[model samples]
Target: MTTTTRTIPFKADHVGSLLRPERLHKARKQFNRREIKAVDLRKVENEEIKRVVDRQIEIGLDVVTDGEFRRTWFHLDFMEHFNGIEGYVPKKGYQFADGVETERYDVRNTGKITFNSKHPFLKDFKELNEIVDGRAVAKQTIPSPNQFFNAGIQNEDIYPDIEDFAQDVIKAYQEAIQAFYDAGVRYLQLDDVYIAGLSAPDIPFNDGKYTREYLIDLALRVVNGSLENKPEDLYVTTHLCRGNYRSTWAFSGGYDIIAPTLLANEKVDGFFLEYDDERSGGFEPLKHIPKDGPKVVLGLVTSKSGELEDRDEVFRRVHEASAYVPLAQLCLSPQCGFASTHHGNELTEEEQWNKLKYVVELSKELWG
Candidate 1:
């Protein structure tokens, strides 16, 4: 196995989505309500996203993203592109930790899941690549195969066999990955928050039909399968998170339960793990990361609130984690995206920028 350093093994990175600027948010709302033409909305999104990309470059980030400006929710927007999937609102919304809930909806697959050439996010990545112009690398983030698994079986009648259903999901993701690579993407991240959720003590994760261990094995299989046949130059990373919705979380726990399976066996270039607060538990679980395994991106800063963390404290925590995993196999980022959804967290735009600036500065101080 190759343990050599890879190109995408950068010192600093991010979870991708940024808080939508008020102007872009307004345009999206207007377009959704049919108050403006799609062309006009694109004009606004294009302008704002250009600024977001520019800021990423200007702030000295290793990879730049479109800030996921095209959609309302990070995962659903991409999932909706699959052939038979659709979302519908129920009487309740998505519930997060701290008893916080929002007007979120559930997605369902009316038919088979497959990648479409006209996938909007793929198109979005293409546009961002053009804007990047080599000043910085362009990165793309997609929901993990486990995301489909955790969303529950909306199409069980069509895919009664669990293995068969997972294979289809794997095929869809593999196609999506290749399409992304064909679009000039050398670095891609699969956001696999569900894996972290499974580690939470509060989460039972088991219904009488499927045990938690069974589901986890299936998730790992699906993730690795989707990564099969990837190009040599492609750098694939997985970001694990408990949850993030408007400064509230959904679960709490460390990477202990999954470290052995996810950190040790997963076929990826790196892991962007959340370790910002007590809820994430201790870094002891990091021991499961093999000596020559994929690099670890330590999320030492919290993205839920705008409040800045002390630089010394953050550095201290970074070193603390190095005890379990070598410092050479580490990177730095926020606990999660500042805005997993367009609504964004409770932080202001200024605070968000400051958080990123801290990451850039900290990365240079330690890794440079």
Candidate 2:
């Protein structure tokens, strides 16, 4: 375990993509239909993204992303850029129960996880690098190998063997991570909603002799295996979320269920945890945070809705968490992105900035 006394105080989250105005969305649809060349769509998206990045910097954010401008959503768009993967409509569509009805989409299969320079993600980052002011750290987020592997199973095609799938996905990401580093991205976060599935009691992965602990070990192994021998300069982290769609969640559980393994086992620079609501449980689990390793970015602000958290109350929560981990090791941000998918959640654009401004203000108040 390595510890750095030097603290980097900042505010940022999976802030890229889905800010695509209606025109860009139309262009992307046309490109997908092959009615227009990808280059044409890329040109428009590039210009629009630059505007978004500039706004992020102008608003006083320490880190900036491309607003996932070119992406349909974080996972689908990223997976679409890869080769060995293919998307097909599932026989029985995914269904999530969250009061209001919503259906899940098709799962991904590892047709191939090879690296290709032509991936639009490269261009996306390069353009972001050029526009993002040097003063602000540029960050990129990708679906964790866990999220990728879990997506490989569609409907009833239960993978008889997961290790084969896990290793392949890891290799694919290892290639992607190396490429991102070569392209000059330092801070990379692996977003994995499946991390929370480790705690869901109804889920079969945790039933029988396979306790939740045992399954979590498997999940971590899959992702950590992908990160083995990664570049030392790359500041890798993981974001654990219950599930975020249109400001509604898919699962509810406490960090107490998975903290020991996550805080102690998973190898990464940090863990961005969803702590904006009561469903995440109390701060006691944070005591398990390694005193010697892995920074914890408390997602103490909610991104689901536009409601700005009470500033003084947020400060009090940060102070309360500091009792377990040093204040120096803590950071703040929204629990998740304003739009985890294409719809951009239920908040207006103005609400999104207001929520982000609250994060920037709160972060400066604590660490500054």
Candidate 3:
């Protein structure tokens, strides 16, 4: 296997979010019920974040994140902080496999979407950076601009044309990139479900208003637009997953549909792709990835379950993918974050750590 010394996209990397500890879960509930003040909740969150950060470093990870410990849902929390967006209970929750439905909470546009200069996540990263204090690379994750389209443009009156709405989103994300870069985040990840969702034949995207290809192209435009002025030193990547809620998934398909466009054109440092099972299809599409372009961090391990993956299987798959992209351009990670939401997957906290530790060990065996 090809080996190299790179810190940003480590051989053993993870998509940011980690499972929330029981105490933090309790603290959130208490704060929601008004049983404790916001300050009290913040204190609990701070303590939990520090502990998780330490655990990540202890497990031999080169990069660490806040584990998204402060939020309930991964994307909604970050989106709602943007101006002109508000959270509300949707008429129905997202339908996952086996008829499993997610929580009803979702975000919508109220007027015009703009990045809040004082976005809470800036402070969140600042606190995380202070805690890390050069011990490890502190990576920050947020939703991709394409997610807003998946959320749907609720107020068409404010944005009569879809193109206009898309432009504003691109601008908002551009500001967000700058904001985070200013806040001292050198590594950033944009968690994306929408672009990958287009590949799932199960979902009827755009409702006949646009073809799958059209939507995919539009999504790529927004993503690339957001990165237009991103600082060269700020390493940005995207994590694409089908869905993660209570150990269930919403869509099932292959990268074959979106691979040519997404893998070939999307401008980013790397792509954290979901390839845990057959649902994501074969690695043939990876051939479209440019040889010298972004590194492909293969998500060969599953995060939804507690059982460990066979080490040999993972190694075989890594080499298999190298047939399309060189082994030197490959890395390993879980298909997605252990906990994309506060509810998390079915795995226990101990199992989650074990899963990550396994990734580290596998990296050492393969690359070192």
Stretches > 4 Å off in candidate 1: 1-5
Q: Against the true structure, whose lDDT is highest?
A: 3
Cα lDDT tens digits, model 3, 152-201, are: 64578798788899999999999999999999988999999998998888
Report the Cα lDDT for candidate 2.
0.73
Write the residue-wise lDDT of candidate 2 on 158-223 in tens digits: 334555656666777788888898887787888888887776555666436456666688788877
Question: How displaced is residue 296 in candidate 2, in Å?
Answer: 1.3
The backbone clash count of each candidate, in order, is 0, 6, 0
State each model's CA lDDT, in order. Answer: 0.84, 0.73, 0.90
TM-score, each model?
Answer: 0.96, 0.89, 0.97
* Candidate 1: residue 262 lDDT (0-100): 75
Model 3: CA > 4 A from native: 1-6
Ordering by TM-score: 3, 1, 2
